[model samples]
Every structure is written in C-alpha cells, then in structure tokens.
Target chain A: MQSMSSSLNALWNHLSDSPLLYLTLTLIAYQIGLFLYQKSGKKPLVNPVLIAIVLLVAVLLITGTPYDRYFQGAHFLHFLLGPATVALAIPLYRQFEKVRKSALAIAISLLTGSAVSAVSSVLIAWALGGSEQSFLSLAPKSVTTPVSMGITEALGGVPSLTAVLVIITGILGASLGPTVLNIVRVKSWAARGLAIGTAAHGLGTARKLQVNEEAGAFSGLAMGLNALATAILLPIVWYWIF
Target chain B: MLFYLTIILLCQLFGEALVTFFALPVPGPVIGMALMFVGLLIKGSVPDGLSVVGESLLSHMSLLFIPAGVGIMVNAELIQREFVPISVSLVISTLLCIAVTGLLMSWLTRNKSIGGYKE
Candidate 1:
C-alpha cells in the first residue's frame, strides 16, 4: 500500500513536469480498462470512455494530482482534434457517391438539427428558471468542441463549462446511441450515422465506427458539417432569441 | 505521413486565414475542415497515405476530449448547484436534435422519391 502510494506520487510528479507523459500513460490505462470492460461484457453501461474517465479521475484523486496538471498533458492530444476532424473528410470522400445522392437531405437535416439543438435548450432552461449563464453553456451543446466553446462565449455561456458539458453529452450519446437507434428501428447506415453525429459529436463518431465503417464515416461527416452549420447559425439564433 | 501532415498544416493555415479575412464566427478548425472538404472534392480522393493517417486520427478521437473532459473540474461548484437544469438541458437538446434531423431526412427523402421519377 505504501509502495502504491509512493508510485502514485511519483506519477503525479512526472505528470506535472511533462503532461504528455501523463496522457500516454492515461491512454495505456484506458486501454486496459477497456479490455476489462470488454471481458466482463456487460455492454452499454461499461463504455470505455466512461470507464477511462472514472478510473483516471480516481487515480488523480488518490495521487493528490490536480486536474489542471493532468490537463496540461491531456490538452496536447486535444490540440490534435482539429486535424482529426479534417481527417474525417477522407472516409466521407470515399463514400461520395452515396453522399451525393443524399446531399440535399443531409443539408436540410443538419440545419434543422442545429437549430433545434441551440433553441430548445434556451427555451427549456428558461422555463426551468436556469440562469442566462447556464443557458449560454447549454445553447451550443450539440456542436463539436472548438465551435461549441466559441458559441458558448458568444451567447454568454461559460466556455470552460461548455467544454465539459460537450464531453459529457458526447459520452452519454455515444454510449446509448446503438440501443436507442435499435429502439427507433433505424436501419440505414446513413440514418444511424446522421443521428449519432447530429447529436453526439466525436464520441458518437467513435461509437458509429464500432457498428460499421460506413456508419462511422457518415457520422464523422455529419459531425464536421454540423459543427460548421452550428457555429455560423447559433450566434444569430442566440441574438434573435435573447 | 509527412505529405499528409503538410496538407493538414496547410489546410489549418488556410482555414485560419479565411476565418480572419471573412470575420467569420466559426473556429479555424471548422474552416480547415471546409477547406479540406473542398480539397477532397476537387481531387476526388484523399491522397493514399492521407487515408491511413486520417484513419489513425479518427480511431482515437475520444482521447482528444480528455483535456476538455478534465475541464469539468473547473466548475464543480456551479455544476453541483445547477446540475438538474444543465444536465436535463444537455440531454433533451441532443435528443431533440437527433429527432429533428432524422425526421427531416426521412421526410425529405420520402418527398423526393414521391415527387419525381428517378434517374
């Protein structure tokens, strides 16, 4: 027990100095957590992302490491997010033939999705007596991170809080996505992909991949396009509403 | 790998420039994505190695959220106090989004098929 605590202390010291080291270690730990979750095979509830977050949080709590210190390392991986989003276009491009056929439908759907995501939150939060600040954070909940962070600020939400909300929203959506789709009887690859990305963002894209490559590709495309659409439109809607 | 890295960087730089020039509200990355999408559209394919790199990037996309995820610590007090409204708002908004998009696509596709003969 003493050795364990000492190692944990060493871990934090190493993490504070070079954050990337912490991220690398976190990734490995998450992989192990994932394997365990899979072996137990309860499914759905044992989502790897959720498990990783829980385990890592506990590890940090026990090791006396501050979240900010851990984040210093983890954020480098986050910086790659933009290039990763751009990379989604490859799979999307490969499926261009099918996409071309449904281009108009996709555009309209994404636009509608973006509007509903931004507006409904404000309305509901208002009805529930949520403060304007909470409304700001909630308004861009459907969008990908960078854009959501921006929209949160533009609409007077807490950007940092918005970022956290974005991750939780993504994890929840991704975890329940398949079960929900099945319940809705959605069968088309395109339909499933659109649903996940339109709602869940990157985590949904990850979930879609587990189901199939086409679903993943389409979900990635939807996630990117929706980010673009939401970023441009949310502020306009926010101003009009508020 | 190097070539794709160059393209990614170029796209980012170009995207940042467009956003700055247009005074757009969108993030540079979103603009980068749009630029990359156009590039892909023009070329009709992602360059060979670009596909591999792109795949690797997508495979671990969730890792990118960890930093932002950890940011949750920044507002524990706020979240605890207003957890109900915030949590509900996030979940409901997401569901509404999915339903709206799905229903719109379903309806639009149906309308398109019903209105005209296919090629």
Candidate 2:
C-alpha cells in the first residue's frame, strides 16, 4: 500500500511538471464551459469564456500554481489569436456587397461608436477616482482583446488589467447590447450587430453570429474596424487630451 | 486547411513588415485583416477552404480570449482597490456605446438610399 501511494505521488508530480498539463487542463475546462453554454440554450449570461476563465483561475488557485507558469502552456492557444484575427476577413468578404452598400453608414457609426466607447470609459473611470493607469487601461477597454492589450501596453497601462477589463466589457456588452438596441429602436440587423461588435468585440460578434448571419457579418466587420480605429485613434486622442 | 493557414500567415507577415517599415502603432493582425480584405476584394470571392478555416476560427473566437481573461488573476489587487470605478465605468460606458452606435447607424440609414439599400 505504501509503495503504491508513493508511486502515485511520483506520477502526479511528473504530470504536474509538464507544460502539457496546463494546456490540457485549459482545453478541458473550456470544453466543459462550451458544454454548459450549449446546455443552457446558448444564453449570453452563461458565457463559456467567462466560465472557462473562472474555472481556470479556481484550478490555479487550488493548485497554488503561478499564472506565469500556467501561461507557458496556455500561450500556445493565445498565439493563435493573430491568425484568427486575420481569418475575420473571410466573413467581411462574404458580406462585402452589403458592407459596400452601407459603407457610409457603417463608417460613420463605427467612428462615433469607437470614440464614444473610449472617451466615456476614461471619463467615468477618472470621475470615480481611478488612477492614471486605470484611466489609460480603460481607454481601450471596448476594443478587442489583442488590439486593446497592445494599446494598453503602448499607453503605459497594465496589459493584464486591460485584458480583464476588455473581457468584462465584452461580457457586459454581449449580455445587454441587444436589449439596449431594442430600447433605442434600432431594428436593423446591421445596426444591432455593429453596435454590439463595437462595444464587445469578438464576444459580441459571437453572440450576433448565433442570432443572425447578417448581424454576425456586420459585427465582425465592426470588430475589425474598431480594432484599427482604436489602435490609431486612441493614442492620438490620449496625447491630445493629456 | 494548411494552404489557408499559409495565406493567413503570409498576410500577417506582410502586415508585420508594413508596420515595422512604417512604424505604425496598429497591431499586426489588424493590418493583416485589412490586407486579407483587400486580397479578397481583388479576388472577388472567398475560397471554400479559406471560408472553412475562417469560420472554424471565428466559431471558437471566444475561447481564444480565455488565456487573457484568466490574466485577471494577475491584477487581483488593482481590481480590488478600483473595483467600483472599473465595474461602474464598464457597465455604463458599454451601454452608452451600444446606444450611441445603434442610434447613429439607425438614424443615418433611415433614409435607406444613403446606405444604397432599401431595408
């Protein structure tokens, strides 16, 4: 019995030492999250990304594992973000005709939305006595994760903090965006999708995609456009204002 | 699938080259997306393989962000201290953002012809 217990302990230690352990754990957690999300009838409130993060955090805490260590494995998944972002052009292409028809409306609305999201976030945080770092971080909160993280780092804010802010912004936007659009009498799929994508990025795009194809396409377009606009505009705006 | 991925990586490489050459502040992937958009425009249609890969990636888009989202653990202290400001701003600003964008798009496209479509 003693020999068997010692062997099991050795096996556990060996598995824990491998980077694959964290990678496998993250994938498994996300699969569970996806299951729950589907089981819940794809409700926005049961966000798989949110659930996966919570589960991973809990696991890390329970194991007393450092985030940096876990990230070593998880970074492989993170690295895919670049290629995935480029993949967004596929949907945009599929909807190009519709996008071209609404070019003026889309461009104008995107500009206004991007500006409003950035400015309002900073102002609200500042008014509530958020530090300078918080102010800068919040400035890019509404943009997509990868772009926003780059913006935050460039602006001297904490990237990890900005990452958190971006996710929460996405969750909130995905949950409340459709209802808000209905309240504002925005009935068009293009408008609804663009609004949510502008505010929530990929998460909003995912939500929009689940509802309607046209809406999803526009949301994807808005997400990419917002990334470009925020990356270019926020830095200039920050320098000009401060 | 491999070919499609290669195209994406090439676009990203081109995007990175452009950013570095111009010293643009934009992320390479965003630039890559733009270039791919242009490529599609020139091509006039998305290839089946490209669409397949793209759709797969996008379908799992939320999962890609999990690594970063879990990064919240690193900022626990800062978040704890600034919880009110952070949460309040996130909720209010997101709502305002949605409203502003939705209203503006709906209003601008109300005439229908301006957007070149009747809907």
Candidate 3:
C-alpha cells in the first residue's frame, strides 16, 4: 500500500501538466457511468452522461483543477462531436423515405416547437421575476451548444449562462421526455423523436437514438433543423421584441 | 475506413468554407450533414463502409458531449443565484414544449392524407 501510494504520487507528479490525465479521467468516468446505467437497467434518470459529468466535476473540484485545464485534455473527445454530428446523415439517409412522406409535418412541427420553446422559456423565467439577463439566456436554451451560445452572445445575454441552460434543458429532456410523451400518448416514433430533439437538442436525440433507429433518425433531423431554425429566428424575434 | 472518415471530414470542411464565405448562421457540422444528405440522395444508397463508420461514431455520440457538459460547473455561481427561475423555466418549458410539439405532429399526420402520403 505504501509503495502503491508512492508510485501514484510519482505518476501524478509526472503528468500534472499534461492533458492525458483529464482525458483518461473523462473516459474512465464515462465507463463507470455506463456501468452504473446498465446495472440500473437503463433508467433514464441514471443517465451515463450526467453521471460522467458529475463525476468529472467532482474530480475537478476535489483536485482544484480549473475547468479550462480539464477541457484542454478532454478536447480531443469534444472535437469528435463535429464529425459525429456530420455522420448523422447516415441514419437520416436510411430514414429518408419515411421522412420525405412527413416532410410537411416535420417542418411545421419543428417551427412551432422551436418557436414555442423559445418564447415560453423566456416568458416563464420573466413571469417568475427572473432577471433580464436570465431571460436572454433562457431564450436559446433549446438549441445546440455552439449555435445557442453564439445566439446568446449576439443578443447580449451571458453566453456561458445560455450554454449551461442548454445542457440542463438537454438533460431534463433526455431524462423525462419519454414519460411526457407517453402521458401525451405520442406513439409515433417520428413525433417522439421530433419532440425530443426540438425540446432537448443533442442530448435528447442521443437518448432517443439509443431506443429506436427511426426515432433516432428523426431526432437527429429535428436537432439539425432546430439548430438552423433557432439561429435564424431568434435574432429576428430578438430584434422585433426588444 | 479512412475513406469514409475522409468523406465525413471533407464534407465538414466544405461546410465550414461555405459558412465562412457566406456567413451562414448555421453551424458547420449541420450544413455538412445537409451536404452529406444531398450527396447520399444522388448516390442512391448508403455505402456499407460509410454506414459502418457512421454508426461507430454515432453509437458513442453521447460520449462526445461530456466536455461541454462538464463546462457547466464553471457557472455554478450564476445558477445558484437564480436557481429557482432557471430550474423552473427549464423543466416546465421543456416538458411543455415536447408535449405540445409531439401532440401537434401526431395530430397533423392523423389525417393519413396530409403529410402522410407516400409512394
């Protein structure tokens, strides 16, 4: 035990300045999360991503490591998001015929959903006496990270606040989306996928993708389209309103 | 394997270039997905190799989101101050949005003739 401690100390000193430590930690935490999630029979609340993130944050706080430093190492994984997002086309292709049939429905649903979410998100916060800064940040909570963050910045909201809200929105949607859909009796995978994607963005789509390919395809499609829709519409609405 | 990866990356690069040149509001990866979709439409099929690579990447797509998610803790102070409004709005609005959207989509398609017809 003493030798192990000394060796651990030595290894830690050797890699203190490098990115590999956090990178490896992120991966391992995800695996642990996966293990726990699977053990729980895929309970939505027992989300692997949430688990991994909580573990990571706890580790960061415990170690006194700044988020920026950890991000430097985990960036390699983050970079893959771009390529993975691009590859969504594969499922979209496979579901193209099905999607094409409901193109009109998809378009209308996306617009209404995206608009309602944004408007309602802002109004809810404002109604609750939330600050104006919170209002601006909440407006783009349904969109993806980079796009949402950009929108928040353009509108003079706190971009970081928006990013965090976006993630929280995602996690909430991913965890509770199915139950809500069930309560509303939305059985069609396409509608479920669109709803999840529109409201939750990538994280919700990820969960949908795991359950059904048809839903996953639509979820991904919804996510991409919502990104575009929010990007264009939010600015116009922002200017119109304020 | 590499060829498929190359195609994906090349599509992304084109997307970035288009975004830069036109100052498109959309994210590059999203445009890249659109371009890839169009290419697939012309190709008339998903290449087996491409499917393999795409599936591999997507299967673990959730893993890719961690770095950004972890970035959340950086703003714990901001969240803590307005925790009530933020949490309430996020939860209620999100659930309401999904329910409304899903119900609308299903209702719109219930006619079986509008947005449901297929060849």
Q: Best TM-score goes to which candidate?
A: 3
Ranking by TM-score: 3, 2, 1
Candidate 3, which segments miss by more than 4 Å at Cα? Answer: A1-10, B113-119
State how far residue B49 of model 2 sits from its true place (Å). 1.6
Rank candidates by DockQ, best first. Answer: 2, 3, 1
Docking level for model 2 = medium
Q: Between prediction 2 and prediction 3, which has the larger lDDT?
A: 3
- lDDT string, candidate 2, A1-242, tens digits: 99999999898789877878988988898999989988999776787878899999999998888898888878888888888878878877887777888899999999999999988888888899999999889989888887788999988998889889999899889888887887887888888889999999988887777677778889988988898899988888888877
**Of the native A-B interface contacts, what share survives in model 3?**
0.72
Model 2, runs deviating above 4 Å: A1-6, B113-119
lDDT of 3 by residue, A1-242 (tens): 99999999898777866878878998999999999988999787898888999999999999888898888888898888888889999889998888998999999999999989999888888888889889889998999888998898988899977877888899889999899988888888888889999999888888877788888899999999999999999999899988
Q: What's the lDDT for all of these models?
A: 0.77, 0.86, 0.88
Better of 1 and 2 by DockQ: 2
Higher-lDDT candidate of 1 and 3: 3
For model 1, how many clashes? 1
Counting clashing residue pairs in each candidate, in order, gives 1, 0, 0
DockQ of each: 0.45, 0.60, 0.55
The i-RMS of candidate 3 is: 3.4
lDDT of 3: 0.88
